[model samples]
Target: MKSVHLTEGRPLAVILRFTLPLFLGNMFMQLYNLVDTVIVGRFLGENALAAVGSTGTIIFLVQGLATGLTTGFTVLTAQHFGAMDPKGTRRSASNALMLSFGVILILTFFSTLFMHRILLIMNTPAEIYDDAYRYIIVICAGLFSIVLYTLGSSLLTAVGNSRLPLVFLMVGAVCNIALDLLFIPGFGMGTEGAAYATVISQVIAALVAAVYIGRKMPDLRPYRDFWRLDRGMAIRQIRVGVPMALQFGITASGTMVLQTAVNTFGPTAVAAFTAASKMSTLLTQGFAALGQSMAAYGGQNYGAARPDRIRSGVKAAMQIDVAYAALISILILLLLHPLMRLFFPAGTDTGKLMEFARPYIYFSMSCYIPLGMIFIFRNIMQGCGYGFLPMMGGVVELVARVIPAAVSMRLGSYLLAAACDASAWLTAGLFTAFAYHFYVIGRIEQRIRRGRARMDASPPAPKKE
Candidate 1:
């Protein structure tokens, strides 16, 4: 139940402490997806796996946009918390909830309406389209829960309440897995069953998160006026949220483009890539958690006007990023065989599938340090309430993926996949770092120096201890 006020703690220690539950929570979250994949792949077969996988990018597009908007709420809340302004924090939360619901309603309505067309635009395989359509529509139809759950999680984490979300997700994961078993194979529900399980679990988690905030964090409970729109705060909220949403959307679009190319390679290729992508996602969860923690950490310090803490926290985060990349790279290499065989049906071509996906894992492992950096640099800039450069970093990622993916598809799917992802990560990482260095670091230092000089010029207050 202990939550960190990161501005007052050792930068490295607090970040690591904060990141641990986030890491665990992300694992469970990824496990939620993995369970669905394993169930569908094992129960229904490769085509079903492809069907489920085919929707991943589109889901990310919608869900990522929701997450980005939620992050705007989180950054504001954390800033107010750091500054010891509970009323502002509560109001921010109220505003976030109201704004987010409007966004989610829009997303749910439109995405559900156009789900099939979007799938067609992605050039989904005809044989798998029915199954994919069933799953995507079910999921998108329930997109309201998805956005709510994600926003709830982000809100909780912003207050340094990472464990609550983790606990919720752990229960959700269990619920999801059990339901996956029952719905997929037990009842012969197939892809639709898996989608149902996901949506149901998310609703449970979101409900818990929503209720917990009201009960446990009374000060963070909004007053009636907090629910009414404040023009200035709403503008600030949208200002931060929109660019971040665009960043997620643009980056997801790049992956959507890659997904289209993967579809062209056949169902077998689709299945292999799906498994590998899941593995890559699972492996890098820690790094992503680190990024989220950094955003919270830096945002708190930024609100407290402590540039020194932000700098130190980011440095510590990058060090941890390196350690994580190295460890995960080795693990991926060591367990490649057994891991690859786990997702496929008993009689499927596990060997061929693993081999086909090998280059992606290998290349991704090699470039993970940079991938980790992208999460840090971009989110740190986001933490500081600066989004333009970070949004541009996402554009760089889009171009990096698109050119290689478009030009290299004829060479081989594996090579193209590897190049596309690796190039995107490296390019985005470099651009963000440059932006942080040039735009953020100097200005923060100047503020810190000016504050220090003013304090030096003024007479010190007498201690009354």
Candidate 2:
């Protein structure tokens, strides 16, 4: 029942402490992909690497839904916990688990059944198509493991226990690396081996998290009559969860469109895009963590009916985000060459690869501030129960991204395509920020004014009668 209540203390210090664990956890989550890319690229060669890389956006398309759903579900748990209502927290947690089961089945079924067609739709290169099919199918089939883990970790995070998830993720990541080495080299399982390793590791993490919750965090455990459904409760969760999931799905669709454009350029370009993107993902974990911190922080404060704290938390978080973005931007620019080298073999001709990838890495790193803003405002707004606005931001991003990528294709300019992400981030960040100001900020102010008015109107007690 010991939870890190973010409803009190200095905003900066508390956010920093919360964000550090979340940051490391985010990096470890990204580590799963980094290890796969490194092992596949180095040991299996370019075609196998490109094959795995090509599945990135599609994987995001599926996993993103799981992430968004879990995140949205837990926002309620965070709120209940913040309001010091254990019964509400437990009920919400149970409903989230039940909801996750239905989603897992549906996602796994569709992703597996239409695996080949999804790849075909993405315009996957014929040479690498078979390998891509094999790799993605395993991930799709084991989609339940990923969803289960996401739900567990998100619940823990909801109650302000980001550290435990990080520990569990570390265990899973290490196990994943060992399995990747064994299956890929020791047993010659090829690209699919990497997929198996990832799924198995996720199962391990999910199981560990469940056991820990059972033993330590009894308050977070499902109700005794877990099967009983509360229609109103489920409806409320769906109201929040569905829009958040759609936001992720919409954003991912844009990436999928961009990936298809990259695919049209052939496997070599695909590999370059993959390598650069892995690095970009790795470097941005800090920003992602800040966004997560804001969600938990905002939710808890909102539940505690402290709009003032939420405002201050956002200010502190933005400061941290801007500073970190500036530092990481400089570091990535300096280390771009060496980092890019890790994705390819020593003797391979990397000139052509860098030719395509350099622009992407450079452009993305240059726009880190906008990217960071997108994470911060969108998440904090969702935490404040304004899900639809963020989803609208995602639609803006989709339009911005798709238009540039398609135009780049028409002009046969990969460089212009590389600018797509920057444009999307800039547009989405602006949209979300404006939404927060126009909608969320006003709402918070109204709540604050009502609380003040209620206090002013209260009957005064007789003085020391």
Candidate 3:
């Protein structure tokens, strides 16, 4: 009901405003994971930290696939809304709920089936394997809650009501933290408690958002027609969603390989990689927010046949993301010591873990520019419905991620782990730049020129002079 129309506005100001709530919301989401990390690390100890860390790649594999698939629904919702087609927007929104359910439902059944094998594939250390298994089990069972929240937040964002989701997200995150303190030390559930904390919090967020959206947003409200299946919408969703899912799956697979490489060094490397990864994710919340902004911005203009707005939006996103990258890099470097303290306590053994993990955060922070570029370009193009080149770039990133991690293993686990991330971001950024500039941007320009041509050929204007 409080949706913002992004079709005509000051590009940067509107995008920044829209992104602010989304940014804070994302940090809250990431903070949910951080709460797990910090609590598990403190209560269950560093090895416990490694157990949760070990599950990162596989969990991301699932989440990434879910996100990629559900993203189409977001784009479609935004497109219809931007075109001012309430009927189509409602139809798409209703269908999006179904689509979201279909994908995550299947994943929930299949992930639990393959959970152990997935861990095995990651080459999880024997010391932490059981711990990792228990944690992932709870998480896998409750993944639908996450899917529900992701779908709801995405739909709300599409309609330009990012603030509402942020409010609910904070509520969920606060619940998670309280539950973490209650479950872990209070109840002695250890790492499993942390997992339950995460799942329950996510469930709360999902249910709250769903109920509110059903009551408030006309496009998402359920009715008799909402139950009817639309073959055309379903088909369009698959055609778009499948490629996006593949790109995500492919990229995540590369990270899985890199994770396997990290596992080779035993629990210390896994724990370190985990801490670095949490920082990397949290630090780049701004960039992720910028990318999401571009996705919504590009989608709306494209739907309205105003392709000329896209280039300007892209330029603005690039500028914002680059600034974000620079700032995150500096802050991480400046606060490296205190930041590391969040996950590891002060001690000789903990200090060893810090040595292994802290470099990862520093190196990753330094490389934010390329990583930010990757997200911004890929997401905006995906929003514009340009799937092929973006999908191909995933393959480029896959090769980049794996080869370096594998080849650099001889240099030691830390370098090998950092190499995987650095190469993946750098390679993916280059590939996306080529696709975005030569293909995505070019087509939008062509469309804009043609739109202008039609305008010029229309009836002549009367001159007041």
Candidate 4:
């Protein structure tokens, strides 16, 4: 029951305090994914790793959509909390919870039934298609756990309670790791075992999060009054959220296109791509967590009508981001060989895998600063009730990733897939920068001007008083 203390005067201190727990929590979440990969790689074998990797695009699409919608909920909750409207928060939260469950159930059903068909549409190769289908089917069937975990975590983050989510994530990660060992090695379950472990852990985390929310924050909890559907609120949430979800899905679809390109190169290349993406995500988690913190910070202040505080928070976030980006980039470059070895091992064309990945990592570094800016910009917009900009940025990324990948494949070079990723960052960064200028800077300046005019006009009245 520790308080968030977000309304304190020191914005940086407040944000950092809030962000640290989130950072740790996100790291554990990333670790859960990494551990799954590691167990599958070391114990289950390369084909197993490929099996899991093959579903990367689909997972990103489904999970990213859920995450995006959950983000919309978070934005609404933070705004209501900032405005000191507990009843509104409760109503919005209830609507969001109901909507999320319904959407998740629908997605779970479709994804499960068409898992194989979707993979074929992605042009999954002949040799690996069966394993990929097996892996995806199991994962999709357990989509509720994934959705619930995200929904719970998003709600907690929205209310400025990051620590609880982190604790739950740690418990889940531990459970996942233990289950991975038992199911994969002890029971000889293979890739299906790994997928099962993941879903079970998700269920545990979701349950823990739900219990905490119900017990601790009674004021913010959904009451019976809030349970009946409010058409306007539901529409507003979906309007804000669906675009964001589509944006992620669109962007992930581009990745699926890229995955198709990588698959064309064979399983070795697919494995390499999978390893690189996982490693990069591991590194990126720190900054991503910071970005989420900024979103909450910005969203709350924006709702409270404190534009200055949002500006200050963005500056502080940028400073932290730069330092983190540099450190992570250096670590990635310096330890590239060792890191690859850790995942791919020595005997299995590790050298070739590294060769394929080195350039992509280097290119990724070129855009880290811009990438950081994108997070700041997008979060700022979301905080200010300008959710559309973030969604637009997602669409820009989707287009950027897809076009280059398609053109590159036409010319027969896998390197283009890496190039497409970098291009997406550039496109997203530019759009986000524009949003900053128009929405943030423009609004703040207008506010300042109006404030000055009001002050000038009020002087005569004060003198008379």
- Higher-scoring candidate on TM-score, 2 or 3: 2
Tens digits of per-residue lDDT, candidate 2, 334-390, equal 887787788888887888899988899888877888888888998888887779998
TM agreement with the true structure for every prediction: 0.95, 0.96, 0.94, 0.93
Give the RMSD in angstroms, all C-alphas superposed, for model 3.
3.6
> Which pairs of residues have clashing backbones in candidate 2?
none
Those runs of model 3 whose alpha carbons end farther than 4 Å from true positions after fitting are: 346-350, 410-413, 445-465
Per-candidate total of colliding backbone pairs? 0, 0, 0, 0
- Residues 1-465, model 3: lDDT tens digits: 498888888787888898999899999989988988988987788799999988888888888888878876678888888888888888887887888888888988998999988888777888898899999999889888888888888888887787998998998999999999999999999788988999999899989998899888886665786777688987886777788888989998998888888888888777777887888889788888877777788778877877767777778877887888888888877866677677876563656667776767766766788888887888888877777777888999999888877775666656767767777888898889888988888897687679879989999889898
Q: Evaluate model 1: give its lDDT.
A: 0.86
Please give the lDDT score at residue 325 for candidate 3: 82
Q: Rank the candidates by TM-score, best first.
A: 2, 1, 3, 4
Q: Estimate, for each residue in 1-465, the C-alpha lDDT of model 1 and write its tens digit.
A: 655688877888888988999999999999889989988888899999999999999999988888898887668888788778888888888888888888888888888898878999888999999999999888888877877787778777777777888898898899999999989889999899999999999889888888887788764678777778777888888888888999999999999988888888789888998999899999899988998998888777877888888888889998899999999999888887788778888887787797668888877887898899899998888887888888999999999998887766667555776568888998998888898888887776787688879979998899999
1 or 2, which is superior by lDDT?
2
Candidate 2: where is the Cα deviation over 4 Å?
A: 448-465
What is candidate 1's CA lDDT for residue 280?
91
**Residue 218, candidate 3: how far off, in angstroms?**
1.2
